[model samples]
Target chain A: MSPFILICVFVVAFLLGYRIISNVPSLLHTPLMSGMNALSGVIVLGALTATTLAGSPLSVLLGAVGVALAITNVFGGFDVTHKMLRMIEGKNRQKRARPELLDA
Target chain B: MDATAYNSIAGILTLAVLYGLHLMSSVKTAVRGNLVCALAMSAGIMMTMYKDHAFASPVLCTAIAVGMVFGLFLSNTVKMIQMPQLVAFLHGLGGGTAAFVGLVILLDIGVANAFERVSACLALAAGMITIAGSFVAAGKLHQLLPQKPLILPGHGILANAILAVMGAAFVMHAFALDTLALFAVFLLFTAGLAFGIVFTMRVGGADMPITISLLNSLGGTSSAIAGFAVGDPLLIAIGGIIGSSGFMLTRIMCRAMNRKLVSILLGESSVALGAQDPAASVSSAPIAPKPADGENKAASWLTCAGKVIIVPGYGMALAQAQHRIKQLADMLKGRGASVSYAIHPVAGRMPGHMNVLLAEASVEYEQLLEMDAANPLFAEADLVLVVGANDVVNPAAMEAKDTPIYGMPILRVDEAKRVIICNYDDKPGYAGVENSLYRRDGVILIQGDAASVLERLIAML
Candidate 1:
């Protein structure tokens, strides 16, 4: 395909993906975010690939910066998600110890 | 194929593989899985640089590795209550990263290309806002900042004036008057950040989850704009998805509270608790607990119990006891008692909070029942196990006019034959008001960690 055609395809695919992913019900969002956040490792790869293929220095720099930022986001998002999950687990444990005290 | 092309393809494939593995792992620990994925992606990026200038790639890769290691260590070390604040910090980091990417693109391309310029500007603004806003949220969650609403005088008018100034600056910047416009942009951005923090601070704890969700959406949108500036399709797609989902979640939360999104944004409806005297005119029918004079002891009670209902809350989320709760539920079922989860819509700190926690524990979705479905069955339940829940089970929402939570729908767990409340203390819920259900004769306040309590309860059974 021509370069123009490839760009069009990229735009179209992104728009379609955005539309489909955007409408996910609130019930499914946290899970999906947890799932997709892990998946964001893809952004790093994309940035690296784009940087490597670039003919110009500006493009290369932009790509490198993008890679760096995307990596941070991936790590940060995962860290936060894990912490949130642990909180949920701790709360559950507290609930189980309720009945024995009444007996005591 | 050219060397560069070959390297690029390899990097992409490696990333895809890592993401797939991360998704497939049922390790149950979200952070551990995410670390593995991030590591793999970083490695792929390093490999691409191996063919040419290898110095920077290795350095970047090593940094990424170090971050992952530190994150993993922190995750294990931090207490559960501190996790949400840490999560908010991470979100701020993500927002900052996206902003950095946008800034880099702008610096590289200059303001020559209108498309890139616009996208970069928006990305920077959104990123800065997200960073500041997340910090504010984290501070509130951690109690570093007060939970009380921070309503500045004339907040609405000030916010509008700041926005208008920002718009004017953008217009001036577009016309090549960069100096004055830059100052205006800086002022506007600062104003916007301050506005977000103050506006959200005024919101009550009951409304925090919605604010967090909205902030998450703002972060996503900023990332998407950054993606556009950098010409990255994946970033745009992922960011847009996150942004839209966050928006929808915020809308749903607002609807649950019988409040409109505009009202929440304007801070008009979230006033201080009214001091109206509670109406005491309801039928004075005392719904007393069944006489505990029967011969069955606590041990025999479980064995003979035909049905059990578990009510979960924010405390359960804080303790991360969903899996243990499910385990106890399973144990109860094995002993011939049917077990089901009673999910209150506004249980915990957010809407659907209990459901989210339970799902994380790998509990069967079918076993969870909504308030409407579970209420009628409570009367028939031999044991009503409340796991770290309070406000949702408080009878005052329906009966007390003076209560802040009046008119809010709650689970009718008080109607159950035996109601066991699992919590740390008799402290009032997020609303700071006492739960009248604590005084109910049928209600039993079981004080301990939810998981340990359930474990002990199961052992006794």
Candidate 2:
């Protein structure tokens, strides 16, 4: 793709993203951040491609480390976000199921 | 896959991600939104692997497995309170990946286009800044580094010099000037690292939200710029989305704290620390004498309050008082008092931090109200129970001009009928501004550990 096209994609995506994310309540800001943090790991595509194209051992090793770190970022971010959401959901269910418990 | 087919699929997936964010605006559909985004991400990854023909690589697969394990272990082990630092650390790793990719691309002799070279330089600098800055932020949040802002001598001048050198190096390397590309890369790397560390080192706890949010933006921008270097449209688009999201949050946090993002980036301390040393004030002035019937008055107000608002802060987290707070709220509800928690936008270490902490304690999500929603209700509230909070509820933010927290939006706790403060001490908060609510006629100041104070209140009820 040409640089012009890439810049277009970036501008369109950023503006659209800003509009969508602005509506997310402060109640979920932490999860929203962690979720976006995971999405930033989309750079793994570049890392994987770099590893595939690397000719030397040092370059390949560095590329593989990039892959590992990116994957860690992706998985760690999503899993933690899932756990946090679950904490809220689980408590919501508990509150529903045991109304009397809270009263006591 | 053909380029058209690949790009088409990528576009659809990007829309799906945005739709997922739309769903995140509401609590009920948020989990499903997360799942949708995760699924889209998984599909995007598979598509990339197929496009790159990387599925068969043993080294790549092994790296993926190791990373998956490490990520799972971290997610499982981290406590709720540690979420901010963990997110910062994860951001660092993501930025590190971008830096490595940019470095590889820059070092490759085959690439000669000026646009690609400039993009690679940007990717490398942004990535380095994100990684180094994020790690410092995480260290401070994790208490590995000192929480106080450490101003290096002539920090502003040093940061500006580094930035100027980096900009010159980027220009030189981009146009393939006489300077060796490798030397230029080294210069950019060093400058990026220095600038990143310099800024984050001067960010204390009160400034954590801004720092973390800014790093989050840099992390995304780095990856997006790397995508431009590598000619990956999907990576650029997704990076842009994440970058914008982080910037939006950063702007919100800055507005909430009444801070200028540029001043924060420049490491300008809001108040002149030496002129208004809170420690000096503490020794010079005695705390206001508690009303002789303070405990009885607080107890009576608590029992009689038909409506109550609980304002919590970083000190609440410090005391690990969320559970006790939940218990206190429950006791109040048992007595037929309607209770809600007022959450300031910058209340904790990160945005929405208090909500997560409260959720962990099983406080009903409905009971947690954002600042704007809870402000008007404070006046109707018969009692305001401040548990370890100071700055957010300090009336001085509105009345005290020229102070660090001046013009900051604070919870209207002082506007309530009767206020009962359960803070660590009568001293100033992280902002170093005295809380005017402490001296108000109807307010009861109980200085002690938050959890024990909540325990005492619970027992009295």
Candidate 3:
């Protein structure tokens, strides 16, 4: 994709995210924050590709580390977000949800 | 797969991820929805790799396997109470990855175009900022770093100067005027990293929530810029999502706290944390702890009270007293005493800090009350339990017009018929001003670890 198109994509996504995030209740901030962190962990994709394209051992090592951290960020971030969202309730609501980690 | 096909597939998955995430906000289906969202994200990632035919790389496989293993272990090992800190740790890792990725591209691919070079430079600078800032935030939330603002004279001017140098270096690289662009980038990286640390340091506990949110966004923005540097469309999309989400959260947090984003970035949080460090706020102040004054008396008030409200703070979380407080609340409920939690928006060290702790401890959802809801209850309540909290409950916000937190809304703890304060010390809270509520007549003080105090109170009840 061209740089201009990519920038436009980012701008559109950002405004959309602002709307979605703004609509959320105050209490859900923490869980939602963690969830977004999980999304950002998608950078792991680049690291995975970089590892294959790396010509030197040092670059490979860097790429490997990047992949590990990015995956860790994604998996860890989402896992905690799941746990956190389960804990939230507004003025009135509560239900015992099954822990999803078992399913994952 | 063709590039077009790959893009289409990734786009569909991203939408699914967004939809899943949107649904995940609902309390009832959150667990299930989050799982689906996570799975979709994972699928998107895997498909992207497969699109490049890079899944067969042994190194990639090994790295991913190890990351999955460690991530799983971390998820299991880390207690829910440490969620904020864990988020910070992940944010730091994200920044570090961006920096490393930018480094690789700079050392290997060099500059592709003005856009690419600018994005790469931005990624590097942002990575340095987040890596340093988030790590410090984690340390502060974990109490490894002091909660107070660490500032020196002329900090703002120096930080701006460093940024100016970085901008000049980036321009030099873009115009092809400098052969040592790598060195310039490194110079900017070092200075920017230092600025991140000092910048976050100048922010106090009162603004921790904003700081954390801000750092989380920086991590996302850096990754998005890194995506541009690496030419990864999927990374760009997801990173933008995270970035915008975080920024919006930060904006909300600032509004909640009645603070501006510019002041936070300018490292002017000492004032934001609240005014001058009056000597009276210190534990050694003349008001005195009156250790013997209340002497094992906290239990009696709870047993007799018809309504009890608990206001928890960062100290409570630091003391790991949420579980015991939950037990106490249960005991109170068993005794036919009404109980509800009063959560201040800026309570504890971060945004939603007390909420997270209370949730982790299984405090009934309805029982946890926001400031708006809980304030009126204080007047009707027979007893108020201020658990390891200071500033949020401080009467200073209302009665004292000269104090920094004067206009800031505070829980009306003084309105309750009887207020019992359970804390390790008589020290002032994050506002750095003494709570006048302590001076009021008939207030009870229960000094010790909150968990043990609550435990003893529960036993007595």
Candidate 4:
């Protein structure tokens, strides 16, 4: 396939993916985002593959750029997730605070 | 065919698998579990880069790994309430990275490519402004900066005019004007940054969530513009998603407060100042429940209640009592009682704050009802259990004329048969006004920690 075809395919895939993800109900967003953040890690692999195989300097540059963004997305996702976990864990402890008296 | 290429593909596949697993988990677990998935994904990405010249050397690999370890430590150590700030910081990082990419591209290739150069310049300006604006917003929310409004020497109109002039300078540079236009662009960027800070600072705490969402959208837009400059479709698509979602979230938050988008944007009418202080007046009313006899009777009557409404608030998020509250709700349901949650839009510091917390608790999406639907049910509810909620249930917002929350939509908990408020103290809400519902003759103020109080209430029931 031509380079132009490859670019077109990537663009179409991105557009379709975005459309499906964005249309999800608000209730599903957090979960969806969490999923996407994980999936976004794939971009790193794509970057690595593209960079390593690039016969041209431009492809290598673009691939390197892609790798950088994927890493950032992954780190950001983890940061958000950890915070959410702490929040839930804290709530559990707070509930156990006066457990003895309540059970009686 | 190269070993490096194979390794990169393997790394990417590993990350993808982890992400897919995270997506499939239950929402409650997913909220916390996604972090681990994200870490794995990031590690995979870094591994793939190991073959690149950037990471091929041992020195580079070590450096990258060290950075990753530090990020992991920070992500784990930071407290939950500070998460939003951390998220904003990450957004800034993303925007700055994209902006840097654009700049590097321009520097590497020179300015001969007009399309790429223009795109890069736009990205740089937008990204830099977003970074500064987000910091100001995060500072205000975190109380690092004062919540008071900061009006420039000239009001909004003048600030906007200046922004326009700066934009013109930027355009001139795009058309091959001398580097002098760059100076104007920088000046305009600084002014816009200040304008964002001043505009957000004046907004009341109730509107901080909206501001955060808006800034988040701006950050995404900057990234998309950067992607456009570099001819990256993935970046544009991802950025667009974030931008649109942020916008929708802001709109939802504004609707919840019954405030118009224009009003919030203008940064006026958020003062929340009232005629006389309700806080001082509430102190003198009565510490002991004056209607103790009635409260006892109501509590006893509710013992065998058939239906209950649980109203949540920012206090719930602060106390992190969502899971316990959900447990209590489940217990009520087991006893043949119908339990439903009443969520006010601006209930927490952000739009859908209560929803996010409740969703984390694995509460049924259907069981969680909006303010409008829940208000009508309160009248028929045998008991109304308010958990760390305030202001939203304040009848003054609905009835009184001389109050800050006046004319604001609120849950009609006042109309319920019996109102049981679980709060830490009789302190005023974020609005700095006492809740009149607390002073109402019928409401019962069960003063204690939200989770503990709910646990006891569950036992009592």
lDDT tens digits by residue: candidate 1, B227-250:
566555445545654566456567
Tens digit of lDDT per residue, candidate 4, span B1-461? 36556435543543343343434344355454455545555555555455455556443344335445555665666554554555555555555455445444444433446665666677666766666766776675566876544555557676567567657756666664556645654654565555555566555456666776666666666665665564444444445545554555666666666678887666554445542332332223334533444445545655777888989886687668888888877777887889989888677655445766785786766677877778789889988888878778887787777766777788999888778887767877656666878878667787656776666655566
- In CAPRI terms, where does candidate 2 land? medium
Best by TM-score: 2
Q: Which pairs clash inside model 3?
A: none
Per-residue lDDT tens digits for candidate 3, residues B195-305, read 788777777666788888898888988888888887777678778878887887788677656667897787665252445552223323234445543645767777888
Candidate 3: residue B161 Cα off by (Å): 2.1
- Model 3: fnat (fraction of native contacts): 0.56
* Candidate 2 local lDDT, residue B203: 83
Steric collisions counted per model? 33, 0, 0, 1
Of the two candidates 2 and 4, the one with more favorable lDDT, higher being better, is 2
**Best-to-worst ranking by DockQ:** 2, 3, 4, 1
Compute each candidate's TM-score over C-alphas.
Answer: 0.68, 0.95, 0.90, 0.70
Tens digit per residue, CA lDDT, model 2, A24-101: 999999999999878887999989877787778777788889988888878888888888887776776886778777
Worst 10 residues of 1 chain B by lDDT: B275-284
**How accurate locally is residue B267 in candidate 2, as Cα lDDT from 0 to 100?**
72
**What are the runs in model 3 whose C-alpha is more than 4 Å off?**
A85-104, B143-147, B271-297
| Interface DockQ of candidate 4 | 0.16
Chain A superposition TM-score per model: 0.57, 0.89, 0.81, 0.57
lDDT (10s digit) by residue, model 3, range A1-104: 79987887677766766666566555666777777767777878767665666678888899889888888878887887876776564223433333444455
lDDT of each: 0.59, 0.86, 0.76, 0.59
